[model samples]
Target: MAVPEGEISDALQVLRRVFGYDAFREGQGEIIEHVVAGNDALVLMPTGGGKSLCYQIPALVRKGVGVVISPLIALMQDQVDALRNAGVRAGFLNSTQDLDERRVVEAQFVAGELDLLYLAPERLKVASTVQLLDRGDIALFAIDEAHCVAQWGHDFRPDYLLLSGLHERWPDVPRIALTATATQATRTEIASRLNLEQARHFVASFDRPNIQYRIEPKNEPKRQLLHLLRTEHSGDAGIVYCLSRNSVEKIAEFLTANGIEAVPYHAGLDPRTRAENQSRFLREDGLVVVATIAFGMGIDKPDVRFVAHLDLPKSVEGYYQETGRAGRDGLPSTAWLAYGLNDVVNLRKMIDTSEGDAAHRRRLSVHLDAMLALCETVECRRVQLLNYFGQDGEPCGNCDTCLTPPESWDGTIAAQKLLSAIVRLDRERRQKFGAGHVIDILTGKKNAKVIQFDHDALSVFGVGSELRDTEWRGVVRQLLAQGLLAVESNYGALVLTDTSPEVLKGARKVMLRREPEPTKAAKAAKTAKERKAPVDLPSEAMPVFERLRTWRAAQAKDQGVPAYVIFHDATLREIATAMPSSLTELGKISGVGENKLAKYGNQVLETLTPA
Candidate 1:
């Protein structure tokens, strides 16, 4: 159905008055226009890019309810709550709802009282739910987190595989699929799986410049994480991701012991405990959550100050999506990672032992290699990250490499020496070894295995003594990233590949980065001092900001919702800086929508006033 001119004006009015945005963000208007014009779209926008507006406005302007297929129950609840706070008639149907609650929501949907209805994809599998949908007029179908439809994605949800039935059943309803992260390959897969081949594709820039990316070698990981929190992110909310539940629990305990409020979340935890912890992390201030990858999908928290990876993720897409969770309010947050060679070995072993065909294993390898390249790259991290998403740009000065550039040296001789050692060990012994044993032989360590293999007598033995053990390991990692070396799936041994002979024969030159030494003492001191400085707000506004935060905390507690759900720290900072007096003036603030102004305007004004 073509949107009438009056409805177009109404949509614009909704954008400004209801949502409190003076104008549409880049590409939002176009996507809204297309969807309102009754066309399908596939949207690939970054986190915090205002993606919800693209369909939400159209839902309001259209004739009936908008059906949103969300993957998580918590996410659906949060969205419905936020929409209701904005004065929109919204409700969700999920397993968490009781029979009476579901009946009420179903009645509202049937009565066309809800502007939007959020449903988990599994709900659509029920015949009764499908019939309920068939009886109502659905303005559009929104498939959020569309990347879950790709079978090869790290965050694949089996329920998402059943979403294509929407297209089959409601052929005339315009559908929009949206995700924060998707490669060209994954994009094609989503399109194919969702039957959105002809949908208009809106690929926004994947750069999240507000998040400063930093990857450091994992030396004394616990101490490093503590240092990061104490020195840089004290009194801020953040996430700490680990690869396993045990690690998450341990880290959470450690942080709690060190006087930081922290909680652990993983799939292995009991459902009630998990829900309570998640609610705590969302509702409380300055609470850190140490979790596995299972915890973060569809999280709508906007003020996560940082996302630190205690272990490496599976792929660049996974890393990007996880890190994108931070700085969603467009404030300066961090994406810090502690990565090392062991992460590489463990991940490779995981791929080898995983239940998949050779092709799938190869694809996993390609994904891991890309992630490794990002870790080992001497160039700008943001550029490499955007390049992975098929965008090209100049260096981003906010990342670690751009801030303190790593020195690159022509490691042609070093590469040859390492490759020569592998060649000699393979030629004489007909065997291979992991990087530790190989590095031992190179550094003249004379370990038991090196002596047993008589590798101490090789020509390449002790040739790498000029470089430190860490430097030698860097060479090995770079070679692996360059495809000159491959880990044998069966033995986890570093073996030569087709390209190794060229490096050994001096036919190719390799330029490798010299890993910088850790500067814990000096950097920690500087960071602590920097943390003491006020962020973005003037000194005069500090009191107002603190009072605003106190009020927000009380409001959030009373309502049982996240403080950010009321208004982000960024918006509060703006309010304190601008110091608006009246309701009319408060409405001019970015996040002060009509409903919020009506609800909290007097309280906010009173908070800003003196006693």
Candidate 2:
């Protein structure tokens, strides 16, 4: 579809006045043009890739109101607020609003005053709501985080299953499904669930050049996390993801106690608290959020400096999508993950006990296996991760492997020693203690746990002490990362998997990177206060930048949507620096789509050089 003739110029005004972006990102123009021309689309964009403009601008430029189905009430509200602040007529109907507020939004919809309306899937199921939607002329039906409609997704939502009704209800309306991560299976499932099998597909490359990916074997995860925060991410806007709610609280407390400005977020917190924490993270600068997987889905923060995982994520997709949240502004960011045998065991246990059909279990297992390979691979982690999504690539040359290659050694004997111990322990009691105690028994140390188990009397005892504790730990981590050993599900006990027998029988040789020795002096050389990134953008840019930022804030608030949903900071900086004057000139800026050009182009032009 071609750019809407005059609409381009108008949307650009909204873009400038509300978002301060002089133009759209690379492909956003084509996406908006396609949608504005009335066609279904599937947008596979990286986080911070300006996917929202694919629909947001079109919704504004086209005649009637835009209907957006989003999963998170908080995120929807944020987006709506941001939009309203920009002077667009936007509102959302979700659980957070009272009946009166909902009634007001409904009236606005009926009166044709709303430019866009965000709704939760569950609310859309109500007969009254369905009837109301039937009465309105929906410019487009946008499914945000469309991957959630697919059961195969990490963040699947059953309510998303009801979205198929859109095709049946409004066959003529254009529908757009957007997500940060979607593999082949996930893409298929999304189309199936949302009844968009025929939608035009736009799959952007998954690479986030700004992010440096690293996977370190879990060694005192808290300490390593603290080290990274102190060295690379101090006083930066970042998120630390844990596998559990309790861990989120503990990590937040620890970071806060250590003088970092951080907050905890999880479903376990009160709704008000969750909202408060989210607000703090978004509105305040340089705040870290220690959260469970429950956070960051649909969050539109553009300046996240890093995303650290305290435990291994269940799948590479989950990790990719989460890490993509960082560096949205096109600035450099980092993806740091710490994993251990315990994390692997826990993840396996969760999958094994998950409620699903046989096919589902098998599919999930495949994803887990891929995740394990990613954690264990000594090559570029980014290469292996992208390959799983069917994208082949050379080394990123920016990750830990490309920067510092670790020494890897044949771990065949050590693997045999560990597996032999598990076999002798009868598998039932294997997981009772940690790898250290198991290593002690294999190396013939008379520790209390080993002595109580009488493991010192076995033939495997004292068979392997040549490796130091650090070396043995490395082997254990590699075995876990390779899926050769698992702490029995639920009990945290060690158990040998089928792969363990292969390693023990010499059918498989394990290669593991040797652990680096710690230098006490090096560790103590710098404190948390010394580790923050230098934010050195031009001082001239700061003042107009703040004005542009304030305009964006008001626009976002008035529109009732997250700020980035309007225009990313990268676009804002381009607007500030390039100072484009006309629609033709503005179109050259990244992220200014045809619809965006029509609605926001003039506003940005006016902001840069007021009439």
Candidate 3:
């Protein structure tokens, strides 16, 4: 994607005048310039990496209204509001709107009064919607969340499959497909599915250095999550992801009971409740959202301080995307996950029972394997995460592993003992048991299930006495991850794979990552001390910052928009530090574009001034 001479000035002008950024971040200028010059593009940038600017700048600089195809209907209001706040004439037509509201936006688009018009992907299916668009000239088509085109992706949208025809219908309109998450395979599928194979592709580095990666072995996970919120991210906005709707509801209620302002979102919730909870989370400060992967796509909130996982995410792409929701403001944030053996077994069972051929199951297993490797890795979490997305990165000292590195040990004997126990149960007893029963037998615990299931007189029983229950569970988890062992499809019982023979024969040695112990507390406290502020806020400016936030909340309430639409935290940080005395001075700050300067500059000055 080359920036043609004399063409980028328009984009740079829009960047400064409309978006109020002095210059482009790493890869944005080229994408914007390429699209502005009537060329198609596919952009792959990390979340909060100025992805919107890649298309928004080109939309502002191009001739006709830029028609954007978006997937989330609930978010269109805020997205459009943010654009309108920055002085761009933006409107959206979604199912949430009444017929009258849709007509107004349609008229505006047809009249060429809107700089950008957003449509839900499903809307493109309507004959009337296509006819309405046919009546207006399109500047360019921007397909946002383009990764949804992947058939098996977690966020796949069937309506997105219709997008390939956009280029066919309007052959002259340059189309740019953009997404914050995609691997090379998903990227290729997107390009082919969207009929953009010829489009110039721009893939930005997937590293989000500001986010600290932390994956803890699951142990009283709800309590661990509470500790994380209370000690590190108290009174800060964040997202917590869970794998089930029941888990989402329970976690939300537990947090609320413990005095944290938490809300739940899931597909099972009524639409109104879901929308209200989402709006509240976005508009209010210091709120936490506990959800399945149903929430937090294209969430533009810049002040989110952490993203915690109560259960293991099934794939690295999802983990990265969900955690990428945090630290969007270029501020330090945490991506914390709590994983255990149950999570691994359950996800494998789900994939086995999942609808699809063997290929689909294999693809899913591949995703799960990568995720498991990430959780069990002794190396840097950030490095493994970046490498998963085909990017290289050094060990960032910010992640849990780099902060207090875990130890690796030859767990060959332990692994051999565990495998022997399973083998005896299968061969002699002619029965299979899940990890719990197996561990109970190995640790010689005469629990009720163990007693009911068997005579404890098995030969391999009690051989795993050298390691504690948790350590034995760790070995089982690693063996499962390493493909030497697997969960039975029907009952989730531990079963040996073909690779098990090599390990049993001592042909291959088993190495396992030893969990870092209580040193995590010291590391956490040090990290917490460093991340106390939103990011780089001086102590003297704290009062001004708090006062400004209060005023902004009031303004957002009056305007009925998310607070970020009024002024992002980054913008407010700049204002508080500068402590401008006049509207002229306030107007010069970044993110105070022309409309906002004229609209809110005086109020900002008044807020900064003494009462």
Candidate 1: regions farther than 4 A off:
1-3, 448-455, 519-535
lDDT of each: 0.87, 0.80, 0.89
Top lDDT prediction, candidate number: 3
User: Which scores higher on TM-score, 1 or 2?
Assistant: 1
Query: Which candidate model has the greater TM-score, 1 or 3?
Result: 3
Residues 84-184, candidate 2: write the lDDT tens digits. Answer: 64567899999888999999999999889999999999997799999999888889999999988887888888899888989898998999999999999
Q: Count the backbone clashes (under 3 Å) in each candidate.
A: 0, 66, 0
TM-score of 3: 0.98
lDDT of 1: 0.87
454-520: candidate 3 lDDT, tens digit per residue: 6488987777777899998899989999999999889889999999999899999999999988667
> Total clashes, candidate 2?
66
Error of 3 at 43 (Å): 0.2
Best by TM-score: 3
Candidate 3: Cα lDDT at 210: 88
Between candidates 2 and 3, name the one with more favorable lDDT: 3
Q: What RMSD, rounded to one decimal, does every model reach?
A: 2.3, 4.9, 1.5
Per-candidate TM vs. native?
Answer: 0.95, 0.86, 0.98
- For model 1 the local lDDT of residue 72 reads 77
- Higher-scoring candidate on TM-score, 2 or 3: 3
